[model samples]
Target: MRNFLYGAITSAAIATLTVSTLTVAPALSAERLSLSTWGSPAHYQVAEFVPMFKQLLEEKSDGDIRLKTFEGGEMVKQQFVATAVPQGTIDISLTTLDNWSGRVADVGILTTPLWDKSMEWTRDNLKPGNPVFDYFDAKLRDEGAIIIAMFDIGAPVVSTSFEITGPEAFANMPIRAYSKGSAQVLQTLGAAPTIMGVGDVYSGLQRGTVKGAMGGLGGAVGLKHYEVTSNMFVPNGVMGTLIHAYVMNKAKFEGMSPENQKILMEAAAEARDHMQQVAIDQLASLLDTVRENGNTVTIVEPGSPTWEAFAKQLEPLAREATQSYPQEVQDLIAAD
Candidate 1:
């Protein structure tokens, strides 16, 4: 699979950009940027947001700007997207900030458990002018990428055959985690947490390689995770909201005309708003579908044994993870 994926990506790279020189050139006329993503075609990020983004870019640029899209890891792997975009392997890519940890370890701090659980809070605070945005911009600039916009998955839950309502329930249960911070928190809570990309999780669950995963309902539905797991334990923002940013190559962005740059940023913001609403409106209905499909939904209360276990195990870890981040950044996440 790895060989096939690599071969496909190499072929796609060659086909996408037929440049003879080592330095990649950004076209001023009829600009065609390669936009890659790891999202499923059905996922809102792909289905709703990306299409809107493409439409907006084309219309706003009078068809001068075009996107050459490659979805679902066909062009670049999820974890390597940050690197790929900056190195001119791809012009733009969308991925979670947590996945940027390999290049910028400070990004892991942004996933500190139970930090900014409210989707609205995330939306308002992560806008282009906000401190969170500034921090992320500086971080991404340092990593050779620039933030186009931010979108999210609300509080992630654990889907398993058995209930994991409390820390005691975590014993011996292997939980699939996507980020280093979440894995550490789950490990602190006594679960055996293993890292896996979202694309490989369904097979992992099927083979019992992992009993369950920490993921959003939207993501579970998108990936058919509910087909394999029986129960979803919602530990009230236990893992916080999942924040994904649309990031582009810094140099590529710099090469764009100021007017084109404005259009890109505006379009990204518009698409971000639409994606957030789609996610918010679809979540409850999606959860209902999960219930109708014969899975149990367990919503853990704030003061329950499960919640207490999370506070005891996950809270301190959150604090530890964000210790080096700016005080305001810490305060923004810690605020009620």
Candidate 2:
């Protein structure tokens, strides 16, 4: 009986050792992820957040997961992220919802000039438990992708060769439009809107093909749009925020262990907060960069005669574009 008890204990110890070996063997080999972004290396999306997220993920996972980054369309074009990520051409991609707006109508709402809330308001309202965010998650999941985080790209301004002091000043000027909603807004203000990518705006403005371009403060400075434009018209609260989302392939995300999944998500939230705060903190400096580059900055006061006229025309145009959303979604978005 003593020998039999000793034999049983030995077998139990061997079984436990084997189970431990099986559980830890996979972790010894790192899982390599191909992470891509459309932004240039210096852009905050790539510069500030991507590295931080990668580091956090790898460290927390003890090098079990590794992120290999592709910056500035290295893996694919900016607009192809949605398809690429799901097809496994890339594991993750950072881009704005506007890139896939053609596939998801609600995605375009992020780019529409209808956002009147502050960044803090937007952050709070779109948190995990919020219906607004839940709606977005459902919409994205249908596309075989998941949004890890969303960020504000700051408000865009009209940088024009001529001054836009009032609605009348917009007459007949050819402005570069970044989105269809923006095009309608410009048209309502009597400006001829030409559609083009932000990257093309510098050359378009420089070559006199377009008199002005709608762009974010950071983009104008980063892309050097100030070199060609003479004026920056910050049209009060009417100027909408350019929000960006960090998206990952849903299947890939689901394939990870719950701990790694949580690690990735937590890192994303931190990166989102860090990026937005950095952008907000750098707004003054970005505007100063514009001025130093020889562009005059004009802030149109809210509710002023000029502001009222622009808002009156723009609000209806924006609403019409986003009318497809349920009333609740619209109300939630438009609400304070």
**Winning model by TM-score:** 1
Off by over 4 Å in 2: 1-28, 318-322, 334-336
Residue lDDT tens for model 2, 235-288: 745756677778888999998889888888888888777877787788788788
lDDT per residue for candidate 1 within 1-336, as digits (tens), equals 999999999998897677633334433557788888884678777777889999999999888789888888888877778779889898888787888887877677666763655777665667888766777788889888999988677777888878765678888789998777678767887889998887888999989999989866677877877789888887767656578888999999999989989999998889888888888778788888889888899887767776776777776786676665667656655553
Candidate 1, run of 10 with poorest lDDT: 20-29
Residue 164 displacement in candidate 1 (angstroms): 1.8
Q: Local error of candidate 1 at 300, Å?
A: 2.0
TM-score of each: 0.86, 0.85
Please list the C-alpha lDDT of all candidates, in the order they appear: 0.79, 0.76
